[model samples]
Target: MLQPKARKAASPSFTSDEKVKRSTFSLRLTKSKKEKHMSHDKTSLPNAGPSYKGQPASVAKEDGARRRARPQTEVPAVFRRSRDDYSRGEVKVSSFSSPVGSSVDHEEEEEDIYRDVDEIEREREWLVCGTGAAVSPGNTLSVAPEVDILDYCQVEWRGSTSSAKRMRKGYEAVSQRFISIRRVRGDNYCAVRATLFQALSQTLQLPDWLQNQDLMLLPEKLMAKCTWITEWQKLPAKAENWTEEMKACLLLLKRKWESISEKKTLAERQAACDALFRGEEEEYSLYEAVKFLMLNTAVQLYEDNQKGLEVPEFSWLLFARDTSSDPFQLMQNHLNPLGHTGGLEQVEMFLLAYALQHSIHVYRLYKHGTDEFLSLYPRLPEAGWPEVILITEDDRHYNIPVRMCEETSL
Candidate 1:
């Protein structure tokens, strides 16, 4: 939980008249009936300024009528899932929807019971960092649209606090190399979102890459080499269901890619990709689909190490079993859930880069200065230029970094 900011003491230089006016204004804003009424009818407030102290009566009446006529925004279908449905691990697999749909329909119950919880969870998650408040309760994860890095950090840079200085300095460092940042929501899926957004978007932009069936089948290849169906079934009762779920998720990815690949023009493909990411169910399914590949990679690494076969030095250590930790258990606890477990670590990021056969270059920023600001996963010279460019302020959360020339690419 975040602590409330300490209030500053009033300056001794303030005159009694000024102090009295300030106190009176604050009291009026909170205690007055007119203010309370205005708060409920916010649309009536004039847009010319922040205050409604001197708005014309005629304009307010017109705005009020318009507000009354406006319909309430409908919640998306993906967010309407009940707690029970989510706990059962049932998901919508309709053509463009998520992986599987529940036979039981609860449309009435969905509108009545879970809507408020979902809204509260969404707002709470946005306010808190690194806290999986939304996903834990089975609410749909939200993604914020991309914004300029300068604009994203602008609010923090206005204060005289230490945090302000840190944010300002970090922005200055990033501004030198990047023009904008697409904030991948930090709800433990940041790594998956950032990687897919960059990698998939690049494929859409490049005709040669989109046309390559081998590239499209990369997930299947990873599964074959890493996850054996016979061995996977040995894992508890969940494995049987997971096998089916994994197949559905894999199909979801293929269909989405096929849909995007059908576009003849670069702009059309880009537009299709944008629409795909915007859908919560489709995006969540794709995120889960990638995790299967990640889990398979982890399993393969663990088995190879057990057999004394060569593996990446650091990558193998992450999944190396201890007295308390098993690689399979780690995957169940961390990879199965949407949020609250944890985001991908260094090993997984490297695995993703290798699994996708693309280099990932990340620009890192810190509170204080550092000798280096860039890190590349699977830093092989033979991999050539990075297909994904990312930025991180604290390293825990990752976002897409766009250069001035690459704005159109996003």
Candidate 2:
């Protein structure tokens, strides 16, 4: 009867409260079950990441032991080498798989040394022989040797039967006054040397700065004087008016003249001159410098002698109609060395003669025929002057050897 009364009247509010509590309890139980299931699933999954809160004690202890076992101060020896030691190969580098190191072979580095030495020797041999080595398209080396131009020519002395017989017809027609005929070295500089030698021999007779040296030293001394003159002419005010070609000529003259002056022996000086002629030691051709120097020296002498007298037109007369012609070019053809063309013109010769204040008598002896001797008198005997006799051969080649006579009395 009491239960029937309670059931009928669990008051509406109390009944609702009981129902709410029951629902809350049921929800809490379901949530707790779900949370436990999720935790079990995470533990069973193999690919699940590490969990900090759920980590095992054994695994944490193992990591701490590994950290303690490592040596913090110990490093490999290979990493301790200095930069210079590495560069010089003092320290050996090893392959990652190899424990022991090996060094580079020095013998392999020196293999080409002997080959380089042999090549240098071969080059020296070629240079001494006056030959150049040419490399062909086939990778073959060939040498071309230069021939001495004088080797093919015949030389004759004055008054010899061979000379007299060859000149029999023209013997009386030419002046027979020279004392001797001497052969000179045939090369690019022969004409210049011969002319210079003759000029020096005559000029040395007069009292000048170059009067004290022996005849053997005359050439070098004359070169020094000429070099000094060239230097003096190169002063700022004077050189400003010179063309580039003229300046180049002057530079070549100075270089060659300096080289000759520096040599202590005649052989050395001769070698230097030879080098200059062959274009071995100089960049500029020597012939132009020689021609320019000769003309300049002659002009200087003429001006010195004429002092106050009205000087005649020398350079202008040499290149008439070509008023703009370079004086250096007018003196000689300097472009080609092997070619026997280009020399002082007649006007230049006359100027040289006038500068010398002497008569230049050239007697050319023949190598071929009966009318072998031809005489050239630059200025006639009526002009009272010092005499310079130049003896030459029939060959019109400018490089032929020539000699100045000991006695030039005609």
Candidate 3:
């Protein structure tokens, strides 16, 4: 329950539709005259999904501009199932017969290995307060220790059955390709925390990249890209005030980056990285920076569609999910709030991949199988440099997967 406070909506002054100019990019605010309509339900998937058992409910196929149509109430295929099942922490398993010799004691032992998703709500009282120590603020980030998937299945599925074992077989196949599975906290912020952990960890290890100013300048670049974002950020209608807020955010980002990137030794850098992620203030501040970047990315896409230019296929996901074409609403309802039940969904992840200029590969495992579940945001042809690798079993929470033979601890 130790989560960041919700970010309040900026005042009405920030929502003004006016033209503003800045050095890097031009900013123009024009209200959309297009009547609010739901975006196409079908979003482009990197590849088709695997058939479950014999009932092959493959992912929606691609059509012109849109992917394929689904129910308006249902979320995109990439993230819907887990949210449906895991959000309430209910474990729904297949009715398949139990494996031979499966014992109650064995089930209990396996359950001990993994924490139930439902237990998260009561976590702070035990993990934080019960220890009788001054606990830091923000969600906790555990050390990424390598875990075996077959063992994971025992607890993940609870009572092992033929279906569970078959599912394990599929994961075993994937585990061969992606070796280390590092479990992350199962809170709503799982997606953001997992992705950033991979990104920042990569930045810290690259000696040639430590001095990369582009990473440092990312905030400014995003602001420039979506010049009208200042309005939604709710700065008073003064241009000067907006600029000041931008500067403040930038300064904060720089300070945090330097603390991690400036360390002379690997051990020192790793420690600094740990501190930043584990500390409440640093963790929350970084999330705010990321929220800004995502907001800009969404707005930029919205701008392109407004201009009558053909946006990329991924734009369907954004427009469809946010039918109103209102970036401010997306910010207020989805991105700004902290510790909300749902964190960043696939739509936001796609935007973040573009916003951060990093590819995010999410490996997913469904109830029956794990084939073709690997999703590359933006669906890049080749792995983007500084790629972040993560996996989700239930689709609701994400965990980092260290590639095979990689010495990286995270």
Who wins the TM-score comparison?
3
- Assess candidate 3 and give its lDDT: 0.45
On the 0 to 100 scale, the lDDT of residue 222 in model 2 is 42
Task: Show model 2 residue runs off by greater than 4 Å.
Answer: 1-180, 201-290, 295-316, 321-341, 354-359, 365-386, 393-395, 398-410
lDDT of 2 by residue, 45-145 (tens): 11111111110122111111000111122211111123233223243221111111122234312211212444434433433111111112332211111
Could you estimate the TM-score for every candidate? 0.55, 0.32, 0.57
- lDDT of residue 323 for candidate 1: 10
Report the C-alpha lDDT of model 3 over 1-410, residue by residue, as the tens digit.
45643322221111112121111111111111111111111122231111001101122211111112232343332211222222222323212212212233332222122343333224434333111111224435433455765555444554354545545654664454455566665444567777777676555433333245654555466555434345333322322555455445545655666566656654565466666666354464565566666776766666666566666556555544432234544554445332232245455667777766676766655432332355566565233356676676544557765544322222
Query: What is the overall TM-score of model 3 with all chains considered together?
Result: 0.57
Supply every candidate's count of residue pairs whose N, Cα or C atoms clash at under 3 angstroms: 5, 1, 3
How many Å off is the CA of 264 in candidate 2? 19
Model 1: colliding residue pairs? 91-100, 92-98, 92-100, 93-99, 93-100
The model with the greater TM-score, 1 or 3, is 3
Per-residue alpha-carbon lDDT of candidate 1 for residues 1-410, written as tens digits (9 for 90 to 100): 55643322221111112101111100001110111211111111111111111101121111111111222222221111232332232423112111111122333232122124454345445432222323323423233455677876664246555545665776766664556666555545667777777666555433343346654465455444434232221112322555555566666776776676667764565466667765355676676667666665665565665566777653443433121023444344345433333455444456777655566766555423543345556654233433676766544567776533211211
